[model samples]
Target: MGSLIFFTVSASAPMTVLAGGVVTTYAVTGSIGVPLSFPILGVALALFTVGYAAMTRYVENAGAFYAYIALGLSRAWGVAGSAVAIVAYNTIQIGLYGLFGWAFSGFAAAHWQADLPWWACALGVWAIVGLLGLFNVDLSAKVLGFFLIAEIIAVLLFDIGGFGHPAGGSVSTESLAPGSLFTSGVGGVFAFGIAAFVGFESAAVYSGEVKDPRRTVARATYVAVAITSVLYAVSAWALASASGKDGLAAGPADPFGMIGQWFGTGLSTAANVLFLTSVFAALLSFHMVVSRYTFAAGQEGVLPRFTAATWRRTGSPVAGSLLQSLAGVVTFAIFAMLGRDPLLELFTWLSYVAAVGVLVLMIGTSVSVLGYFARRDSVESVWQRIIAPGLAAIALIAITATVVVNADSILGAEKGSVLTYVLPGIVAAAVVIGLLWGYTIKLTRPSVYAGIGEGGARQAAALAGIEDLLAQDERIPA
Candidate 1:
């Protein structure tokens, strides 16, 4: 459970959230109320978890949302959910390369006088992450745990510095006021704020790998959300108090520059190094997510069977990890060749798409929870079965709507620009294609279609054959 939380929260990238996300959101949206969004999102997600955790006792799979939606609603919707998930998680994973590259490049130039391009730095980290993905998940968890601990320490010290030295020598709670979040820019706050919690739902993505899925998934998820909410809220409030209401609009573009002013040059330099590690940890974590989703899709026949291949000794998804690495390489090359700004264009655009995509999945999963419990006889209470998810679905609907309406602000495009439509259209297009492919399978390959979200049980023969091949090629463990 501790390892799972480490994997997911590292994906949230605490240092990146403080230095990049929180300050940027405040600057972009001009909202001093950014501190309040974390707790608000936490409440919504807690309500969401009531039904989500209940479903985990029954359905255990790597593709958590995809499996639940398929079983509860229809296999067609599950297929569609898988497709959107692939795109969403891929974008979030690959998008971090841009931020990682830019941060690393700046750090190298500053300290070592080594001028490296962002793409080069990004590819180097990509190579490392790709290699790590093929090892046992526990290995990856250990790596994430180390980085996450350092990140937490760095954030806490920075928060202390901010609070210890207020902008006007007195801490202010103006940003924490509930009324501050009700302004015209609230949509931007929710959109950007939710992006900071990107990896919280990923606890269930590791359901099959854990020792105790029932308790681990539920407890890890709730704890991750609570810790993230408090961390983000307090750090954000401290940041605001440091900047003061008047200085927030004009805060430095590089947030650490402000941190340097508060905590001195030594800590700022250390924080910058940790910031790079934070983004790398997030890349690895999200890479694990995308690969597992692809693995689950293959196990269920949503993708080609080769994707289900795993290394016997490590139990790692061999083919899915390679496939995601290939996707990352191709994406990095395209952005590098086109000369896009890593932070502004690559990170901002794709991260927002990921945020929106995950929100869509949550809403679907919440409704699916209700539908799932409705069809079966179970010991779950009425509150768990109906009321909780029902209200969660409603809350998510409103939040997603608000996110969509303020899409222009989040993406930094002019109002009514095609980029807004195009970015989100990626998910929409995935849904349409997924639905069509799912229906075609239902008609033409009914046997395969019947096991669309059943995970490994229905794919035993295919997995055995792959294992035989692996053994022959490399003397893999039986």
Candidate 2:
């Protein structure tokens, strides 16, 4: 369970968020207290987890979102949610390659003077991730743990240094001031803050592999979210102070470059190296989560049986893992050919798309939480079942709306441009494909359709014709 939480927290990639994302927040929102959003989002997430944790006690599938949503809503909605999740997670995982490739190649050049194209570096990473995915997740978990510790140490050191030594002549608390957060472009701050939190929900996804799913998954979920929130909030606060006014002004344009200026070249170089490893950690964490989803989808008969095949010795989702790597390679190749800037074109666009997709998925999950408890009563309290999830759904819906209305600002795309629509369109397409596929199964294979998003006993009934028998018996009584 702790290892699973490590993967979940590592997936958030604190180094990347502090170095790149928070800077963007300052640039866009001019809201220095962008740090405050972390706790706010955390609380919202905690509300979400209330019902989510309760649901984990009942559902038993690696397809976390799909299974929960299916049990709560309907099979078709679960399939649709799964399709969107695959796209969202896949895009974000592949998008990180953009940063990793560019950073690694640049690192080699700066140190060893080994000049290489980004694609070459990316292909090397792809091979490594593909191989790791074949082994037990515990091995990769260890790797993440090492990287995660190093990452935490570095960020904390940076924060402590910033707070101890004033940036200019004096450190200012204006960034933490409440009024600062509501400034001009705060919407972008909220948007990116939510994106930074995308990975904290993964503990529930690893339930089957966890030793005591009931208590472990619930405990891990709470711990992961709490850790992530503090990490982001504290780091952002220190960064704003370390930067001073002059530095803050330039953040919108290049936070990475500005950090180098504040810390001198040596620390800057170290940050660059750490940034590459941070991205690598994020990539591996993403692979594990997505493979589990794919494994569940395939096992539930929504996808090919091949994807359900776990590794013989390790029980890892081998087929799904390799497929995710292959998809990443193809995505990298396409972007490299276009001559796009890895940070701007590759990272920004797809990440925004992913963040938006995640927001949509969470809304679905919140609804599922409410429905699950309402339709099927359990011993859980009403606050856990209804109140918390209701608040979460309302909050998530607002964020999604904000993103849609302010797409141009968050993404910096030209007003009414094709790029602006691309992120939202991918999610829509996934839903369309899922709906078509789900309905097709419904028409052609009613028995399999009965269990489209089910698992464990519910799925057994769907597969063994128990539902059909129950229906017949109901009619006979009349």
Candidate 3:
């Protein structure tokens, strides 16, 4: 179960998002340094993960932020963390909806010469995912696994061709130089690279479903990060090398297109097919993420209790999944009604908003890691406890600031600065609301609030102990 969730979290949606759009943006922004930036960001994130994984051993909860914040700080902080998560996941899922619709429509037009609207494609997928979410998690996992295999094969083929047929003559070391990396400014590279690793930490969110929460979560976290980092580094390097120094600088309209040219028309067609498959995987993964978060928040009493209720047999959040699907449907309808192009207009617009939200959430998580381990008496190193988190916080904050300052360029905005300010502002508002909600809970229901970080059974045990009751109800019934 843990492995399945980890697969869903890291492999599915991210492959498409990173390959289709983010990689091109990274090449443009970071130049040859794009390959190097990924590992560096991975290391920084790994530092935070050390403490994050360690804390998981002590506090087991489906709500990752809820566990971290409650263990490290107060319930108020946990609630705020949860809110950031909700916003981040929701934004990402919705943004992908727009992208999926656009990609599907484009493929249909290219292959079948069909002029079906993008939203039509989006709505169809939305309905399918919603129906699937209401059933078994295993079914969703199977679908994702199939998509993952296809995407990996596609990426590998592209990478092989990249090295096999060198484009623009030969590769250059200048693209990997420190100057080129820092030249485009570290902020942009950091933001783009961080986006590549969005789903890495999601392994913990499946603690409830996993076989061994303690070992599985830790192993999955490290393995997922390691695998993803290696893949990104190799693929990015291959892309940069394939494109060559001049091509890298020239900024081709389609980086993947250049790869196709080197590999021949057949491979290019395969890549396009893979690209669509990648988007489908990403959509499935994002749907799982948002639904789980909704489930976690609801269980914590931050939202309605119904959202917490799971399908007894499948162990899926039926209500939360339905809610997320409904939101996607509504957003699809709105964009279609406005006569917006799903890819160019809606997906591009909302993806930036989601990116910003994720940045804020990552920064918060890094900080929470630092705070959680600050005064520890364990054998943990100071680097993991203080230095790494502190450095990551600084880096993340600087990246966030840069994105805010240059939202126009970062988001590919054509006009109106309102979206630039509005998106970040919305994330801020969500955090504030979460904080207030936490405080309200503290005043009204201190017991439930105090039980935040402790696992469900542990909390029930503590409550039962306080009442001098038996342990029968504390254990999950056989």
The TM-score values for the models, in the order shown, are 0.90, 0.86, 0.82
* Local distance difference test, each candidate: 0.82, 0.76, 0.67
Candidate 3, 1-478: lDDT as tens digits: 4464446344535457445455545533534576677677767666666666555555566346656776677778778877877777776778777877867787788678999788888888887777777774433566666766666666777667667766666655565677766653454455556656777777766666767766676677766776677777677767776766666567433545655677666766676776766666667667887787787667666676778778878878888888888888887788899897665456655665666777776677677777777656755577657776778778768767876675555455533477667867877888899899989988997766765555555344442354344235454321
User: Whole-model lDDT, candidate 3?
Assistant: 0.67
Could you tell me which 10 consecutive residues in candidate 2 have the lowest summed lDDT? Answer: 469-478
Give residue 112's lDDT in candidate 2 (0 to 100). Answer: 89
- The best candidate by TM-score is 1
Residue-level lDDT tens digits of model 1 in 436-456: 998988998776777777765
The digit string of per-residue lDDT tens for model 2 on 1-478 reads: 7677777788788887876677666765556778888888888888888878778767766446777777788778888888988888888888878877877887788778999888889889888988888884434566767777877877887777667765775767887777877654555677788878887887787777777776687778788899989988888888777787667776453334444566777776777777777877678878887887788788777887788788779979898998898899888888899887666567666777788778888899899988888887688888888998999999888877777666666666666788667777888888889878888877887766776655644344444656566455442221
As for TM-score, the candidate ahead, 1 or 3, is 1
What's each prediction's clash count?
Answer: 0, 0, 1
Model 3 residue 328 distance off true place after TM-score fit, in angstroms: 1.4
Q: Which regions of candidate 3 fall more than 4 Å away from where they truly are?
A: 1-14, 23-33, 139-150, 164-167, 172-174, 178-189, 205-223, 240-267, 311-315, 374-379, 414-416, 458-478
For residue 403, what is the lDDT in candidate 2? 70
* Cα error of candidate 3 at position 119, Å: 1.2
